[model samples]
Target: MIKIYHNPRCSKSRQGLSILEASGKEFEIIKYLEKELTSKELLSIISKLGIKPMDLIRKNEAIWKSEYKGKTLSDQEIIEAMLKHPKLIERPIVINEDKATIGRPPENILNII
Candidate 1:
């Protein structure tokens, strides 16, 4: 099954969702902010994305700048910060079975789905 960690307020996330809708393939939308992810779940996502935990962080978010920026953190620490501040997580992460991608460009989802 395909799943998307979406933030409706984000235009890019909306676009990604639109793409999924247009594809006519069934998928699940995880309104991540509304239903926070557990540390283990987030870790699994990071693993499927084939990237480091930090790669999934939205570093430009105010919470990141005010609290997490300029601080050297381990992978676990970064994941903890994301758990504490779900807004710090990047939007529209699409996962399909073992493959996943951060849909910053929106179109990247097409490749995986």
Candidate 2:
């Protein structure tokens, strides 16, 4: 099944959701803000996206700027930060089996879906 790690408040996230909806394919919408991702699950997603932990972060988020920005961090520390502050996670990550992509343009999701 396809799964979308979604933040409903984000326009890009909403746009990604719309794409899924228009596709008429069954998919799971994970309201990640409401249901936090566990470390194991997060790591799996990062691996699937083929990106470093830092690449998955929303660097502009106030929490990241105030707490994590300009500081050196290991992959685990960055993962911990995202776990502690879910808002720091990039929006609308779509996962289909072993493949995943961040929906920055929202259209990026179309590739894997």
Candidate 3:
């Protein structure tokens, strides 16, 4: 089954969900905002993404700017920030089995799915 970490308010996230819907594949939606992810869950996602913690952050979000900008943070610290602020996470992360993708252009999902 496919799983998407989705933020419903984000247009890109919505687009990514649409792609999954169109594919007709079985999938689960993790509304990270409402449900909130655990430290372990976030870490697992970062691992599956094959990206540095910073790479998974939504740097442009206001919360990140006001709270975390211009300060050096370790990977663990960054992960902590994201867990404390789910809006700081990059959206529409799609996982299919062991492989995962960040749906930026939203089309990136096609490669893995």
Q: Provide the lowest-lDDT 10-residue window in model 1.
A: 50-59
What TM-score does model 3 achieve against the real structure? 0.98
RMSD of each: 0.6, 0.5, 0.6
**Model 1 backbone overlap count:** 0
Give lDDT tens digits, candidate 2, residues 16-102. 999999999999999989998999999999999999999999988999989888999999999999999999999899999999999
Worst 10 residues of 2 by lDDT: 59-68
Estimate every model's Cα lDDT from 0 to 1.
0.94, 0.94, 0.95
Give the TM-score (vs. native) of candidate 1: 0.98
Stretches of model 3 off by over 4 angstroms after superposition: none
Superior by TM-score: candidate 2 or candidate 3: 2
How much is the lDDT of residue 49 in candidate 1? 89
Model 2: pairs clashing at backbone N, Cα or C within 3 Å: none
Model 2 regions more than 4 Å off: none
